[model samples]
Target: MSALDHIRKLHLPDGARILDVGGGSSVLVDALLRENTSWSITVLDISQSALDHAQTRLGSLAKRVTWVAADITQWIANDPVDLWHDRALLHFLADASDRATYANTLRTALKPGGIALIASFSLNGPEKCSNLPVHRYDAQGMLATLGSGIILKDHWLMHHHTPSDKVQEFQFCLFQRV
Candidate 1:
């Protein structure tokens, strides 16, 4: 997606460790491998089914990725990563406590100056997805919610049409650890 174009512009070091939190079956992993196979990429998800699906989809290239089956709020990485990307997970943290844990985990997982690319439902987007309530935010609201230590590097909004023919607004924010 356009987000990756911006990420690619970062010109991260070769063999940089990247973590895709709550990324389950996203073609980003595939595209990333195609772009640079040297980067160590880890894809984490709470669902075994999703991971399995991704593994199946990736086929032989699946070995190139580290697949972790765990909840982001409860999971901790053994080592820090240079870049973190999340596309499908944050909106589900409707509970304040859950958001705090997620934010804390994010802060802990990154190396200093590391990059985080997060996407979520915008304030003007849907209030819920799959019948679960979502917490929505504009760029400033998201920056406020994340609080300290995260510097807002860039942000933008994009419109997505679902398979069911529904319009959903997505806010993409890029942050760097200070």
Candidate 2:
């Protein structure tokens, strides 16, 4: 199972609201739905086409997911989520100001004591992905960037084999809002 799948299996409060940051076309929502349909799952992405594609792929199950098309740095969340998950999205925030905005937005969107599950390109990984520049990080970097309010719970590195058979290293960090 992927890091995301593993995180989803962890014991969380029943009926926790989950926000999949930059969820886009990822299948993580589908897995979450299968694991616990009772939990409210929302997918926030900047691309409408990505949301549309995910909705198409989900078919009847799509109705259960709340999809939002907006940039995370400035988007106002309609729900106070208990869990926030981001994969590679933080790396895309190349500008320091943008990263700060993202951090502020994260703090504003999630309720304290909530779970934050983030995956990012490791320091040794490619400097660019999907034709865009990326910022590499280790667990310490992520923790520092996220600020002291983040209480580290777990951290690890994983090698992901993409659809094109390329290997990309990623650092996964799990934190609880303190």
Write one digit per residue (lDDT tens) for candidate 2, span 1-178: 5745666566766688999988887989888888876889899999999999999999999999889999988787656788999998999989888888887777777788888899999998889988999999999899888886878899989999999999999999988887
Give the best candidate by TM-score: 1
What's the number of clashes in each of the models? 0, 0
lDDT of 1: 0.87
List candidate 2 stretches off by more than 4 Å: none
Can you write out model 1's per-residue Cα lDDT over 1-178, one digit (the tens) per residue?
5656876988989999999988786878887888887999999999889889989999999999999999888997678999989885889998888888888888889999999988999989999987999998788887777779999999999899999989999998999999
How far in Å is the alpha carbon of 25 misplaced in model 2? 1.4
Tell me, by lDDT, which candidate is best: 1
Report lDDT (CA) for all predictions.
0.87, 0.86
* Colliding residue pairs in candidate 2: none
lDDT score, residue 153, model 1? 95
| Regions of model 1 farther than 4 Å from truth | none
